[model samples]
Target: MDLLHHFPHARQRPLRELLAEKQTWVNQDKKGFLRYRALLNELRHIRATWLDLNSDVVHIGRPSDLSPADRVHLQAALCSLKPWRKGPFSVFGIEIDAEWRSERKWNRLIPELPDLSGKIVADIGSNNGYYMFRMAFHHPTLVLGFEPYVHHYYTFNLLNSFAGLSNLQNTLLGIEHLSLFPESFDVIFCMGILYHRPSPIESLQALHVALKPGGSIIVESQAIPGEEPVALFPEHTYAKVPGTWFVPTATCLQHWMQRAGFHNIRCFCAHEMSSEEQRQTPWMEFESFQDFIDKDNPGLTIEGYPAPRRVFFAANKN
Candidate 1:
């Protein structure tokens, strides 16, 4: 409680304070936690009394997050960087936008994705191998990445080299060249590259070829969301101009999975944003995040994924 009270906010936190400042909600949570703790203890005692259970019940002190040596090192690091701003930016972009975000986000995708324990994985359209690296970092098993862009393939190779991830293997290939894979890998990450293909369904069929039966795919794509399909991702859809490709809503996405010889399928609505929110987001592909800093007028910035928000789908090959 003391540590939480003194914990610092590295970046601006507006919504957190606003929600907490409301006296009605604040009073409820404060009173609620105490009452809940008391109720839990009472329940425990009652159960113990009924069961005649007692081992001289003792209170165990919870361990601190930072050990004594870790605290010492942390203090030394803090002291060494006295003024703190060695580089241009003081806070990361994620930190700045943390309060504006909802709980449902892409950050959880990598962790909540199915376990790859004793499993091989494939990362399709593995641009610079971001999601693939996540699998390799967490599971440390064999991973294969298929990338079409030659420069991006080399960049992925370089990043893998620096990461020293020995189990990861990659080749310069697209969904079209998936015949190179002999129908293996337990899990596949298909993210940020789905809508780029002219026929998204065709790409899914190709991805299915690389995955073993019962293998799974965790997907995140630029979705065209509405009651009916429309031309939303036309201008900067990335693959082709006036792109005829369709980004299936959650319902349509499910239908496609069933048709693709996949089963036991489910989906997650990963990214969500309002029209007003979309305009505020910076474009990482164009320039560094710092280059687009409009701190004085955050609302004025115009540019980004236009049709409000997008969604991702997670499905299986079986």
Candidate 2:
């Protein structure tokens, strides 16, 4: 937890201090908060399971290195951390098939982003640091991930400890906290988060402020198919899921970027989310996209809104 070691200039306003300021809200008596912390600490106590860092599956340990008892212990520990929403990780030879096939998003966005090698990157709304770890593959100088949810934050640490990724740091913070950051990042990745914000424009502005001058940003979000510039503002929920505010068209998203003071905005790719891309697995056994989609017509949600088609847009801070 040495924040200063990674960010030497943060002595004036350290990440630990920021988290301390929000201690009351973060440590509120939310369900499973204490248990999640306990599990994370317990995981840290476990002996390091040696593994490779640069692999497609995020290999954590060789199967032959562990005894039968060790494998069982590792599986039990990992299972305690349920509903892993953002990964498809291989830890200690056990495949934690997460809810979302994140690799698909990575595959789409990587081609659209600038080379991350030696770049200081930040992943806003980093769920369990999945994309952050993937970003490390490009050999970034440093990777900082911000996740507000305590459970996901702890999970990120547990995985980082197991993976031994010294270059990556996952902090318990949110996009709102980005205002406290200096204009330091070379690149920022914002995915599956814009629609969740009540003020998407302001969120983009915060991102714009956080980036170094001439830095780049990658935005990926659900899109309502259309050519005209428009965004769908759902009343309460879209696809029976809450907190989904505005699903914008690609053109609409470009306009938001332009409004946020970003130049060279480009909506590079848009693709429909598939069942195979997000489904119930051993690690995350819950309602999935199939349940939310219109059974009679797969092109729309059960509520008759357009189905989830994600789009990626890249822009530069001018």
lDDT of each: 0.48, 0.82
Model 1 lDDT per residue over 224-308, tens place: 5465544344444322223435656656666766766677776665454443322223212223223332345432223332332
Q: Which candidate should be chosen as best, given TM-score against the real structure?
A: 2
Clashes of 1: 0
Q: State residue 51's C-alpha deviation in candidate 2, in Å.
A: 4.2
- Give the Cα RMSD of candidate 1: 20.5
Candidate 1, which ten residues in sequence have the lowest lDDT sum? 46-55
| Cα-lDDT of candidate 1 | 0.48
